[model samples]
Target: MADDPSDQDGALSRRRLLASSAAAGGAVWLLRGLVRPGSAHAAPGAPPGLPAGLDVYQRAYENWAGEIRTDELWTCAPRTPQEVLDVVNWAYGAGWTVRAQGRRHGWAPLTVADGTPAATRVILLDTTAYLTAMTVDGQAADGSATVRVQTGASLESLLAFAGAGGYGVTAAPAPGDLSVGGALAVGAHGTAVPAVGETPSPGHGYGSLSNLVTELTAVVWDGGAGRYVLRTVGRAEPDCDALLTHLGRSLVTEAVLRVGADVNLRCRSYLDVPAAELFAAPGAPAGTRTLAGFVDGTGRAEAIWFAFTDKPWLKTWAVTPDRPLAARAVSGPYNYPFSDSLPEPVARLAGDLVSGAWASAPLFGQVQYLLAKVALTGDITDVLLSGTLVQDVLTGDVLTHLLLDGLRSDLWGASRNLLEYVRPTTLRETANGYAVLVRRADLQWVVSRFADFYRTLLAQYAARSEYPVNGQVEIRVTGLEDPSVCGVPGARPPLLSALRPRPDRPDVDTAVWIDILSLPATPALPRFYRDVEQFLLGLDGERATVRVEWSKGWAYTDTAAWSDQDVLTGAIPDSHRAGGGPGWDEAVAVLGRLDPHHVLSSPFLDALLS
Candidate 1:
């Protein structure tokens, strides 16, 4: 414990709080049960003393979107696995739910939520302090080396660690700032669908980061021992699916991931594809620069179409051993300084929009497109002329084909550096995200439907003089992680991964993720999101299976997020149960058994698992 007077005062206040709560409610047994075992009160289930080498503090937590805020009474920085175990045991004994806090970069309420009961005692385990140990544990049977790391390690650190040894992941979240534990907890994934000319790589899984884990160490309850202990679970275990994507119901200490040899990558950027042709209706024609066509040309692709802009900045990545013609090489992440750091004009427009100029969103969006075009390509004159030509002379399809010639290229260090391009210091906004799993053949169908829906909704909002969306609509595709990638026989896909193939549609192997981001302050943002959510949710079990992105936003009601009863309690559970095996229920049951007392649960998790 620190020698600071505030620490003493906080401790005194906590003690007094418990005493007063019990006394005010006339609950004598509550006070008796909460009293410290060896203290003057000598209660039975009181929290044990802080273990040595652990620093406890009072801290307030806020989710990435600033939608949820929580102030935990007891928080600690655990330096080692033993420290994590000690904190878990103490919290369990004291009947306090234990939540591991990393970067808190996720939008979901998996850790702590706005609705968590104020009276519920909670303890946050801060993992980044000292739990970021990384070690190469020799090679695995799958040809890739086994790298064991504490879950608290940031993705950037882990990627750098692997890159130092000439190893890398197949795909990862764009933001390098995310912690490995946090990323895996929500099944974080990136856009990397195998191209037509691509070949599967050994020791690499295109699925969520959770899919890369060969083994993990978690602080689970040991009923026989009557205390929390670290248990190493392997990928082959039946309960491993649930653990891989715990959805914030469990605490993982460390994980051993399988990584393959690193490869140089070429990331090409283009901003000429017109929205109508790029997101054309399914099976419109044979030759078109559609999103699916781009994915077919290159295994990796991302489309960032500004709200009301016809042209979207399309980025595609390809594996390359050497530099290509007319390309530059980038050494680290955040390669797009123009996109990550909003330009002066864009910032001003965004500021105005956020400052109650909701009507200016359309104009704000156009200015954003202009800035991105000028900054990325260094030639705004041609782009401006081209946009005018697109609207005036060429039709949608003809204009799109003409614009496809604007592809630019650059080489990046490795998969890790190239894949992580987004920076936290960049734009901040609320987003609704989802995954639409369909067969590769059905890619056109799903994407077209989404694009059409989005376009139609934007038009409707415009007709009503409402510009709710202020950010781009992002689109990406990735191959579902086949169990074979784990090199384990009879291995199952992560039960909670959105990329998991539905039992009814075993042929599905591709997941098209879509997201719409906007400032929370935008007028009618919630209503717009709700409309979009309903449309996506309706796609479930029809053309494609719709699943919420665990780390992003979903379960949207007309007024707020995570508020839709049917979607939360029905649609989401049904999506997890798509395969018909012991699905969400079984996973929840297993997690519940592992923590029988629910010592690792929160109000949000309880509802999600309910």
Candidate 2:
């Protein structure tokens, strides 16, 4: 399994060249191919009678991990919010559907379904091309500030802008490439909950990023005008609740989000923690380094356990006004080069798995684990262990080179640098995601139960000589939505957000997010995910509830995801409808009112949202 020296050298050179070019080019990479031609009528696949003066072209559609793809369809970029409204009106009149296309960094079919024909009456509105505009407004007396930003702006750009003004969000999704509108559409979140001694900061929320939205402007139907119009709604408005996390059922043009003062953070990575000890039952030995213990100490942590591995890579981030001596100071995001660019040997193993080497799942898992261990800690003692496939892949030369590159075990920097690590260059894997709402005391219990069931289920699959998972299990915890943090009176939680608090279970203040990832089209993955979903659905019984992470896979059948009728029509909607709160039903009704013509929706959303 050892990689050829020449191939390794070439791969390293290519990665270095890419990194250097990216640094030099800056945001040019995101803005490439965004130019609008003078004549849209001449463009291929351009439908007749489309809105004039818009950039129109034929663009193929692909989601994150390449799970859903389609041939070239009619696409356009609107330079202004009024143009967006015009496009929606045109689509509504022409019997066509308009799906807002961002960076396409999502797993769900909310934007466009797979196998959509080229001639289908669906036009993609490319938001990132022309709608990216952001400006910081005045600061408030409560140490909070607001930023008015268009939906097409990337999260990295937004944070960088905020950071320049000494403000930042408490948490955000790891990938910096995600568009702000796309992130809000899915109610994206990061791992954080209030620690034992931590105090709430004004304008800072530990829930999904959507909770920070104080006001948003979206295209909604105007009954009196009988057309779609750009309407601004405040958080206090009941209609704003549905627009906060519309799940692609509505198109948001721009938003005003509340933010707080910036804080530096030190992120420490640990690769030696045994999964058994870290996820042990609640009443374990007093000194055991458990997941809950880390959360109690820092309030922000994430556990990434590669499939079939014994130890998980646990990362804990603590707020540190000043950098510690042992921590390396980083000035920017995506600090983990080892993860952003895979080593040649690891890439080869992944290729082998994709080429149908099913039995290599165990070896793949171990290689991934060892790769992280060496990359983060510079310790290759595990790789030196005799008679293992991992040793063969992570040869002494690879370990030496990785160690020479330097360790990334501890890093301290601005919150944005430490919080955002994922890059578009990382391995593309499909995932199944969920959020389990439970009391803080039951966090350990939920982790233990999931770990036990996952281990058992994986073993059974292996025993039957079927390997489904090739990636890792990611676990993160966050606080439920608390609208007061937005500093808007009478504001309510996002009705469709998975982190929405259950009114009846006031004590269930935390949400434990669990995601299982694997290569796309892996045999038997659907069945494996089905089992996991069923287990989680009933994990805590009356004490907790499970909700689907909107952007990832869910509602599984033995053959595919989003196919289970019961989970889609019953379990999912019921989770929000429970406690008789104004959630699922209300959100659905409002979304219907906003887009009564359904110009912004696709067939998948029509079925799921209905």
Candidate 3:
């Protein structure tokens, strides 16, 4: 589906008209406002006993989706690991808490709580400023290698460095801008599982990134020394399991991660599959183009279902040593230009919805679906044939420009290029996340049940003139953590990772990650999310388990997220406690022992972990 030059002139005129209309709606203004960086300034007085020469300032804190914001707080950029230790010691003795700030690309309040005042006795340690040093350590005899990287390093830089050394992880989170420290702390993950008849490569893992760590250095209290000090722990150590995914209760400065030889991947996007068939029940007739079928073929896939849309945009990635004839070769990541940068039409529609045009929710959903269809397949027929609302928003000029800008339906490149596609410029939406651990055979059942419930709930809301969701529903599948992949004897799965295997149910090896996203302030979203959470908490009965994704929103109430006391204190911990062998309680105990003074803890962590 290539572009036709015969329609260029007319498309250009139409695009100009649409662009002017979008500008009038303040689309460009909103885009600029979202991307503009916040400024920091020198504080009038530094904290008492702060280490000399440490760069300290007051800066505002804002999370990825702008759902969490704090006033100007004391922040410091330590130049070395020793400086970090010094700050920790000072905070411990001065009755203050220390929180590491890296990229601020997370949704949860693991780092700092919303509305934190400047006078609060907490300091934000900026890791990205000076601690981002990475080096390729030696390689082992089995072609597996390890890299020593500072926690402050961004995932993009770490992947680039590893890829340059002919080593790379099997999967990583979509956004490369996230700091390595934050990603590991939250047990961030990407989608992949063993394809049928496929064996995993040496040092490769399909679970959370925390499973790849072999050694880590963290700041911990020392009873003998009478203050906080640096402690290095190997994966074989029992405490290391808890440190692997500490949820901001501990601070890790550096880590040694196992990496396998780099592999090329071919990622293909499909927009023709209807949601009903894709998420069909498990017993559907054989040879259907179901989600499970795609997983069996490629092992790595993600489904993005726009709200109120039947056909979803599905992306599948396969290990490809040689470029496929139909795939476009790429050298870098963030290949989805249409999604990475908000189109004028999309921005305009989003602005309208934000400005109280709640009745346009259906149009907005259709526009998003058509945008993906045209951008991925280069087929503008649907947009051209759509009703006036879609056509007027997505004019011919915009469609032509997208086609001529080199977006492709299928792309082949290095592993990093295909794995990391979400750029920082993309529209930021608040999301609620969970990982449903079930037997591989039951993956289809889980997906189908969730899809049916979500569809019904969305319709019920629409019937009440309520439009709570303005973003897509994302679904991915991955394998549970296998400690043997770390290449360390006696290594244990991260105690707090959502992918941690259940001893009582060895058959539950696959985790189906489900997330629903929406604009930050959408009305009735909290209620919708609460209903979904309650349903998922009871899904699959005793045959499956659902655990919250730490980096995203969870613990829901009718009014807001992360506010349900029953979920925060009971259900979340119990999810990890069930079928357990050294799970939630063990992780909390170890984290508490490491930071006896609670120097690295936040109020939210204290409540949730307790």
Candidate 4:
């Protein structure tokens, strides 16, 4: 099913496009699912890198955040999947648990250990030194324009490679620092305004850039089945399809995907659209999105409504044809952190790295990551650059609406802040779908622009509405590209089938992400998560179910309720749903077929295989 390729088949006509409830790009994605990655892991014995050995003191100290780190980590720079499997197999015998890590840039225990026994034996199989090869072939094994990427490849390398070959990825995560594997693991994405005939959609399992991957090769451990490199019969296994959202208890090694002819991209972003005008705009493009800002040459487009602050709304965008992507400033990251608060040492490093050509990594550990964030296009790290303030928004709907009102009227007038969670939609499948939670934080910002409006809205809304719903509002959207669907011969659309790289999750089934998640133990958020559960369940249709992003701490019961079989079956098979399927028995059986000695099964696999 090659999708429609024009702006006309667009879900709407000009005037009526505003306020259109039709979630534009949603229909096409109805056929697939997307969650998307970062943070790299190192393996043992290859190159004794810094922070070597799990010396008790070192382990705790390395992860300064505490909750997100565990003693189960190794510090070697593994450059091959065999190295990954060797570590996994060794850990199985040594009774140590294992995990794959990238960048290690997350703020939470997303990759940290839980109370699981596996936590005791955890090891970090680092991929930083892995083979970073990306190749473009004239034809696929079956004959197509294919791009082959090793798990360690970078998004920038792939883009630059495609450009030289006269091709381009349909879409990619906003920033370019993330490793190819890391980015996909977290469901990273950029806000892509659908083409005229296209529809606007959410970012879920796979987005525009994801369609590129058509094949995946990985190492799987079924305990009883042992360790075997499983080759999924593409059109035969239903598990294969649902499993793409997760790497399926396996370590992804490499992938092959398709790319499209290179073409220039035109992007234009600006702000300032009245509220009444925003809602009053034509419904979203027929079935997609509505232009919400400018009335003439500047079409009413998209807007971001932040939580807290008097200024409730900020950010707007519209694209013009033939304008192409702006040439990146020759050197800007070195300019500054936009604030004096950055530690002097860090500040100095950030500026120097940016001012230079930036070809190599920084001498200091976290310094390179810090600077890379500023130098790259906005993605997870956009906050640091935008000077975004993080806060805890108590739970309440009225508070939610009030905070939004303040954002537009008082706090931030034109700037926006974003949140990124690399967890599953619901807790049951915490390893599946990653959601990039976006919202504006900090009423303190009202000190600058919308101060009075900010104070007034928060007070008014708090009094009227039940309260606020999580000082943050995770207004959700999705982008789905059916891994099962692909383009036919001779068809060249903006989104090619080669983009769907599989997703990877290398954390404990659940990890405490950061300090904010360490809420006092009490009501346990049953009510709040319930409302969220009900709404997501409500969104479930006969063929699909809505999933949440980084929902582990939202309460086990609430997550269980939101992920019930009747609710999840539409989106995922009941067999694969959780404690179901051929259950662990089938998994073990397959693992046996793949690995007879159970060489790869660790305690993590035993929980399912035993």
Candidate 5:
């Protein structure tokens, strides 16, 4: 919305000085190409063929769960497109691989790893340092809005930019810290759909943020130029589909996303619904508060069922033009105060568990459940208004509160604000995530079966004196990013996006995302995750297709995430094939052609792309 080239120049100059100072002062790593103005190289041990005057330094990186960490390596923060292009070309020529580093709020090892030779001769392309420019690129003929953004820009910045420009995404991941480049690369998403009595917005699709991309500009090999150059790919091009969700096989510098008019959203939470009733069998009594029942009532719903507990925290968001009766109006995000900041009691329990009180894991789990219960009930006034209405509007058991209490669940804000509900610093835990795509009719059945399986597995683990999980099982539902909704000529859904709809199952438009969170220290998490992974993957293909969420943990084995040999070699490849379609092959081929030298790669990516 505003232009300031001078400000950009100043910022770049300051970063250059920092890089130069670090290099001159015996910096551990150097930006191979970015030498100080008076120096030939940034550091004495500078690698060959690096361009001078680049912003490079030594930096350590960590993934969200702290499961993925990379030793301090030579990292570059390119502020402009030319800078990125130069870095890629230099890396290609020097035989060094480059990986884009966003917020690293992920569990996968697509970018960097903890150990092994793969971490050698690798450099992190830190996008967040300088490439965060965003501009509204005018409206299309169909009245759809378009905004061009630097890939390194965080979702929070993008949302702020969009809100300022009078445009916004239909849904976004709860954590605002995710970088635009990372989210698009991994198909990050949020829970959203057309409400029961609402009409779908124009130029909006209920899919991952990757679906919002109308065009993306990336640094790719250019034979004509004999160097990597910035190339803008339109959504209609087949290569665009592959780039939409590149899985770190390629690098994107910027993207043009199609967005719609901003809207107000009201999100409410309820925790009295017993897991048994909510996840009951599909044919259970009509009055039961089933997961599907919540979805049918309002398209947006999330259920967080804590381990070793009966009640689940149910959050439902609906598009509301104005505040509903007895609902507390929220001004900003992170409305779940207790969740945003751990309560003292819970923190103490967590500390003790971390301090070698391994056997206290079960007790820790109970404490967490009790904390949530106390926080939810004690602070009802903080998130809701008039406890009498909560009591009077419901009928039958405590579960009835779900029906009437959802509207009064204490937070009302704009879609963007409400979507940014996750705190930047919160519980750090390893999580296994999956997206189960099924038709609306099968939502109840799928949820029930999965919940039953999870419950039984936890019981079995407990029987063996193994408290594998101490956190909650979070479940959310969202519509797939239907390409047709974008209304772009020749637009096709991202080939690799989990939200991509299947051609054979036209009726299967919704995706149910489930997450099981627990600390990495959990004694039996890997085995527990393995069983869950198998159950999800073994679901009836005709009824539901399970796919790993790109940024979240998956491919569970007894020892690690993304290390299940069968999943990596079989299930993953097959799931992307989408019932023997050529899309997967086509996407891989296009990506290969774009980066013939594989300049943009890591060991994990190399294995997957190979």
Candidate 6:
């Protein structure tokens, strides 16, 4: 929000833009909907639904990627829980499949139940359109209180809303455009309690936003019931636990979050920390643990590590900086001046043409942004990356030795399209704590099949035992948010673990959460997924579990599970799963209840039930 003309640190200017044939703040109202043609699985009775006028081309767009120009489901938004059930019921009744979509944020067709033989006769329920309402936690008239937001609401809007009401989210990943529900659905997080004041180092005692979800309203299609039913559960739920972690079978409609008081961070964006020394660096331009004067007030600092480069640089920013330090001349880094309420992508891109043209070098997290910014501006995020074939990735940690080193083999290139979706799952420490924003490239069966960027990077680095190309990558830095899933990870009483079937086995009750995501749009997308997966499996020899991020990684990564049953739960596996119990048993019974006619089923959903 500064108007400094001398803002050489990459501050965007009007004249600089016109000189570069760029437009700043240009708004584009491109059609945003999953225009895929299909129907949700409804019961035997099909209400005379809307006419068959719905078609992909009819709407001019389809959200195969996620909401961000980042992913292909961008066109599909969130719908209310009721809307979710309606779509499910209608699809069931019409003898079509129903794929629950959240922000179309994921790349797998798991959410797509339309136009393809797998789910062509299915209904796609957009989830981003869902809205959220806030109030003081515990009805506090004076003191701070928790805020409940809808699953489909955008995180940017939620933050702004909370800020306006004298509050701020407790934590956030990066990227202002992501939604709360989408983040949690994929286990979004940030580097926790990073070194800030003097010494820049990493620490322990971290967690995921999944641990914050106090409650959630998930739409589990009860196939046997033949009627849509709503079930509300506590943080420690039974049947709802698995759904809380992964968006596989049960579709989430609402996420009741535990919010904190309004607070701002004093961010001092600094950089040049190469990725190679990211973990071992004693200190750089801005080490996360203690940038010292970098952050003033009680606010904390966070770091960004890029993947493509040779050294990991730090694009360090503070939650709040000291007044005296803030008064001094700030770093003239090229930064994105995001608006309080970021305009629609098109308008923002037009404006960026002018504002973004100031610099195109992405070395310090600048170039790829312009490209993505332009891609989004052109409304062809999916169109641009639509020329690949699909393949699988392994995300589960402690993965079988058989799959280890598979990437080093020759099976990779043989796949026409080899992609791996990457996500920053867990952040026990703020410096390393991270979350991933889902992208649109994952929607196409062809694109996600490629190797992940981070994976390749990790594989190359594994030999060296050091990665130095991470700090300040443009693709994911600007976007950050706390887990919006609203489901608390490792919460007391473990609601997420409560609703499992565990009568015969105690292990099913205590499970871990892994996220599902689509591949990035680039060739290195698969590598990103692999590196993160290996990181989760402690492949780095660090002996630490890599935190699972929602949009960060998916089934193919080694950070999460890929077993047929594990895939069903939709989270990383090897730990305990939802156990068997009356509550869980009852919940399973309802899947039958919701689809008595057995008309509602998909490889994605059936995988879960089987």
lDDT of 4 at 564: 42
Give per-residue CA lDDT, model 4, range 248-301, as digits (tens). 234566666666544343223222333333333233334322222221222122
Cα lDDT tens digits, model 6, 421-444, are 122121001011122221111111
* Each model's total of backbone clashes: 0, 0, 0, 120, 5, 219
TM match of model 1 to true structure = 0.87
* Greater-lDDT candidate between 3 and 4: 3
Clashing pairs in 3: none
lDDT of 2 by residue, 1-610 (tens): 3442324423222222223322332111121122233445234535768888887877667676766767567788899999998888999899999999899999989999987877799989989988999998669987889999999999999999999998998899999999999999999999999988998678788999999999999999998998999999999987999999999999999999999998999999999889999999999989999999999999999999999999999999999999999999999999988778777777767767765687898898988888888999988777887456777778878788889988899999999999999888787788999999999999999999999999999999999999999899999999999999889999999999999999888999999999999977789999999999999998756878999999999999999999999999999999998777899999999999989988989899999988
Q: Give candidate 4 misplaced runs (Cα > 4 Å).
A: 1-67, 105-111, 114-119, 139-144, 185-189, 198-210, 221-243, 274-303, 309-321, 324-478, 484-534, 538-544, 550-610
Tens-digit per-residue lDDT, 1-610, candidate 5 = 1332323533222223222322232111121233332355334465566677777776556566656644456777887888888888888888888889998888888888765332378877899989999898868665578888999999999998888766777788999889999999999999876666767777676888888888999878888878888889999876899999999999999998889888787787787888899988889986999888888887888888777877788888877889877677876666665556554444555555444455666565554554455444543331243233222321133323323333335577778888887765566667889999999888888889998898888888888888888778989899987776655688888988888888777898889999998765567788889999999999998899999988888888887788887898789878878855546778888888998888987778877777
**Residues 1-610, candidate 1, lDDT per residue (tens digit)?**
2232324534322223222322232111111122223455332333456566667655556555555554333567887889888877877777678889898888888888864533458878889888899999777554577789998899999999999988888788898888889988988998887788677667776788788888888878898899988999888986787888998788998998888878888888788888888888876678778988888888889999988888888889888888776777677877766556553434545555655678877765776675556555655464446554223322344224333434223545677868988776566667889998888888878878888899899999999999999888999898886777766677777777777777766788889899998865567888899898888878847668788988888887777888888999999998888767656888888888888878888877887797
lDDT comparing candidate 6 with the true structure: 0.36
Candidate 6 stretches with Cα past 4 Å from truth are: 1-83, 108-110, 113-119, 130-138, 194-207, 220-226, 274-278, 281-302, 305-311, 316-335, 338-542, 554-571, 575-602, 608-610
Model 2: CA > 4 A from native: 1-45, 386-388
Clashing residue pairs found in predicted model 1:
none
Between prediction 2 and prediction 6, which has the larger TM-score?
A: 2
Q: What is the alpha-carbon lDDT of model 2 when measured against the actual structure?
A: 0.88
The window of 10 residues in a row where model 4 has the poorest summed lDDT is: 25-34
Model 4, TM vs. native: 0.51
lDDT of each model, Cα atoms only?
Answer: 0.75, 0.88, 0.87, 0.33, 0.75, 0.36
Model 6, residue 463: distance off in Å is 15
Ten residues in sequence with the least summed lDDT for candidate 6? 409-418
